[model samples]
Target: MNRKLIALDLDGTTLNDVQQITSETHSVLNKLRDQGHIVSIATGRPFRNSHYYYKQLEMTTPIVNFNGAWCHNPSDKDWDYGYHKSLSRDLAISMLSLKDDPEVQLIAAESRDGIYVHGDYVPYPDFFPDGVKVSKQLSSETLLIDPTSVGVFTNTQQNQSKIEERIIKHYGEAVEVRTWGGFAPCLEIVAAGVQKAMGVERIASYYNIDRKDILAFGDEENDYEMIQYAGHGVVMKNGNDKLKVVADDLTGKTNHDNGLADYLTNYFNL
Candidate 1:
């Protein structure tokens, strides 16, 4: 078989319940890498949070972070095929309107530069281990540059929907808003037309690989584009049914059972 580009989605697809890469998975991926196959991560997580896993897996390729809102080669900072599609500064600052809503807990804008938070509460501390949480709030002075993405954390799904609806109604043309895949009732907003597939394609092009050789595995709404774009998209047994319908194949096991590794072993006969 020809060399392939394997793109992985971190949460609920690559990582197990505890958010660690199991030994079996690590072994299979390393063996594949030793065989000349390329492995990379395409996720909704910011580089701050995903960097550990990238280093843990010992990946040397560019990462698609923030669901393709940012892509860069962390191993080789000199690698120039990087891109960051940020929301306009005006748009980011405009999100401040939601901060005062009683149902809204937090509103944050993130970029490689840093995070600008506009609330008293921090929703997921693990996701922002190095963030400077303050009651200070996001302001034009604090968020000077355009941000790669904006996150609105709400207290409930109903409130989340209300906020999402308002965002779409007002800025539908300029941004893409999605309900984050985590258990938290939050909304993730990125520039319009951005998706994981865009970054994966960029990586494949750099490697001179064709679409037919791209193998991607994912399990959520954010994975929709990449899954459809890959020549072979594998959805886990525990994946969303919407993805399963469009995916080329389905893993017999869930992430907890090392589903990605299982599929690779059988497919490549490793």
Candidate 2:
């Protein structure tokens, strides 16, 4: 096979139920890297929460974080061919209004600057690395810089959807809103037209690869655009039903069952 680019979505597609990559999956990925295939992460998580996995996998490729709101290569400080598209600071401040709703628990924003939170809720506590803190309160005054993404965490799925509708209705032209799948009931907002595929495309160009050689895996609504853009869009068996409809293939097993590793092993004859 030619040198293919593999884009992985972290949460429900790559990590198991406990949020750890299985040993079987790890071995297969390492073997692929040895074979000269490019592997990179495309996740809705902020880099702060997803950095451990990137280093653990020993990836040198650019990673798409915050669902492609930010793309940067952690391995090369000198790599200048990446982008960070952030929401206007005023828009981020305006989003804080959602926090006033009874069902909304927290509203947060993240950027290379820092994490700003309006409430105490930390959705994925384990994902955060040590020394990283939710230090600043999210507000017009404290949120001095534009954030790559804004998150609204709610108490229930109904309320989450409700808030998503409200955001679309109000800031339809300014942002793109998506609800997270599997683990939590929250909504993710980024600049209009921002998606993981954009980041993947940039990385593929950096590696001199074509779109037909890209193999992307994901399991959520946020993964929709990236999956559509990839030549081989593989969704986990446990992925959202709507995503499965558009995916080119589905994994034989769920993420917890080492589904990605199994499929890659057979697909590449590794």
Candidate 3:
């Protein structure tokens, strides 16, 4: 179509199941860049985790990280040049009431700086990585630190009602809590206004591209808004069955099949 910008989600959309890009996909992305299509990444992952893929794609567009809590200028050094914008502090406090159980690991985080893992679980430093991990033991008491947003990780994926109830209670009107996906019933908390849509909007504003000229691809809960906002949103064959209901088009293969790269390669190779 006439799309000039492409906002891609990394984990479930761009990368394969193994969380790596196939050379075919990589090569296609390189070609997309050469063809002068603005490509950027919008993800729920922290900025650091998001960079891992941006580097792989050699992306040159701004990155929307933490579901739009922050945006990074692609031209800057790997993790540098991030701009912060988020919800109010009291709203965060109001959201905490949604926690169903104190045993759950509740943590708020800064995009690249760190996370406060609150719970009985003692997370080792490796869980976070080089710069994002705070250099101290996780606090055991009820934490009030304003992280970019709160996150919950548990080993239980069943009991949908309990999980949804907790999310509704904690975030209710102040914050937005969505159960991203986990066989373990994990949830993600972001400022009410923070989402992939916001990130894409920011990126478009920066480049002056209208929503009608942007193309996006994704296949998950976090991807819903971004995919819907783009002019031509594509969903993968392997994406969740529910998302296909909203896709503008469907790619023929799965990530493992290098579907994304294949799409680009075939288009340009024509």
Candidate 4:
């Protein structure tokens, strides 16, 4: 059998509704790895937030984090093929300026140091991990370095759309914007041309795996490029409707029902 490279998006995909990987999914992934298939995570989450899951899976392959703004092999300190793309400090400052709008409740920037939040807003504790500092100011002077990604949070869907539109219009060709639904109204802004597909392509090239031998799984706007790039793009049953339209196939079960395990079990004939 030809070994394949499998990329998984964490939230609302591999991870269930309760934010835990089910035993069934875990076993299936382990079985795949045992069969010599390479499995890696491609997520919009930062390294700090996604590290726990990466460790849980015992993955040695490079991880795609911050929606492809950062990619690195956590297990290999000597690996020099890592990619870390960030928005320019000026562009980051432009994004941070959105906090002035009343519709924009909060804005945050992620860097190697930590997540710097602007304005009078607070994120959940889980959003900030150990050693990841959380600051109240994200000014140009304070942001000594460029940011991997910037996030805008709004109180309503309408506001979310407005902010996204405003930013995209003002920062055209400078950044990519994506919105998240179902939970809080939020938008993730990253450097131009940054996408999960880029990370997948880089890893595939490094491993000498053809695109046709790649399988990707995702469920949200951030996963768009990756799902389209993969030979077999599997979208969750509970995935965004837009994503489902472009997927090669859809899982019969939802995330809460072990969707990933069920799909891989049949696909690999495990």
Strongest candidate by TM-score? 2
lDDT of 2 by residue, 1-270 (tens): 899999999998789988998889899999999999999999999888898888888788899999889889988978888999999999999988887798888788888747888887766656446643646888878888888889888887667777888899999788988777555677989999999999999999999999999999999989999999999999999998899999999999999999999999999999
**Model 4 poorest 10 in a row by lDDT:** 123-132
CA lDDT of every candidate: 0.87, 0.88, 0.66, 0.85
Q: Can you write out model 3's per-residue Cα lDDT over 1-270, one digit (the tens) per residue?
A: 444787877765787766777787777777677777788888777765566677767766788877777787856666444566655545544544545564455444343555554444433322455644453333334334556765666546444447667667755776766555533345667777666877788778777888888878887766777777787788877776677788888888877788887666665572
Q: What TM-score would every model get versus the actual structure?
A: 0.92, 0.96, 0.80, 0.93
Model 4 — TM-score against the truth? 0.93
Q: Assess the local accuracy of residue 108 in candidate 3 as a C-alpha lDDT between 0 and 100.
A: 47
Candidate 3, which segments miss by more than 4 Å at Cα?
Answer: 1-3, 77-83, 87-111, 119-127, 131-145, 156-161, 182-185, 267-270
- Whichever of 2 and 4 has more TM-score, that candidate is 2
**Worst ten-residue run, lDDT, model 1?**
128-137
Best by lDDT: 2
Residues 1-270, model 1: lDDT tens digits? 999999999888999877889999999999999999999999888888889899999999999998889889999998888888999999999998887789888887888757778776656545665655422358998777888999888887667667888999999789988664455567889999999999999999999999999999998878889999998998888887888999999999999999999999999999
Q: Which residue pairs show backbone clashes in model 4?
A: none
Better of 2 and 3 by TM-score: 2
Better of 3 and 4 by lDDT: 4
Error of 1 at 216 (Å): 1.0
Off by over 4 Å in 1: 120-122, 131-136, 156-160
Local distance difference test, candidate 3:
0.66
